[model samples]
Target: MGERYEYVPHRLLRRRVRDIASGVEGELMAVISENVSGVGAEHWVELAYVRGPSGREFTTSVGNIESAPGGEAG
Candidate 1:
């Protein structure tokens, strides 16, 4: 994994992040891990829960998040 991916989980919590594909920006509320089985093995994926400005909530993959424009977490 690249350095950016490694730091994503640590830096994302309570911070404003944007969903890369959907262009949805919000404050990240939590990160959840889920296990999956594939190819004779198991792996975990990170899921991020975010709340948007209008109080809308959604979940997206951690891989889809990036720091929101403007600044750090308020």
Candidate 2:
């Protein structure tokens, strides 16, 4: 793994994470596969789905988050 790679794939899903940029703490709801099409090509990527305290759902890059403090029971 690279020195800056902090995303632990197996352990992050359904866990709590804090968005380092926004400071919004929420549950790491899921990692979903998304298909994208480009110029004569196609690819898939995993996006992190998160639910905030207000019940809003949004997708963010896994690199933008970290494990929430006080462990996973949030």
In model 2, where do residues sit more than 4 Å from their true spots? Answer: 1-9
Against the unseen true structure, what C-alpha lDDT does each candidate score? 0.76, 0.72
The runs of at least 3 residues in candidate 1 whose Cα sits more than 4 Å from the true structure, single-residue gaps closed, are 1-9, 36-43
**Please, what is the TM-score per model?**
0.69, 0.71
Score residue 67 of candidate 1 by CA lDDT.
91
Best by TM-score: 2
Clash totals for all candidate models? 0, 0
- With a 3 Å backbone cut-off (N, CA, C), the pairs that clash in candidate 2 are none
How far does residue 6 in candidate 2 sit from its true spot (Å)? 22
Candidate 1 minimal-lDDT segment of 10 residues: 1-10
Candidate 1 local distance difference test against the native: 0.76
Every model: Cα RMSD to truth: 6.3, 7.4
Residue lDDT tens for model 2, 1-74: 11321233647777888877788888888776566545665566667778999999887776787898964664
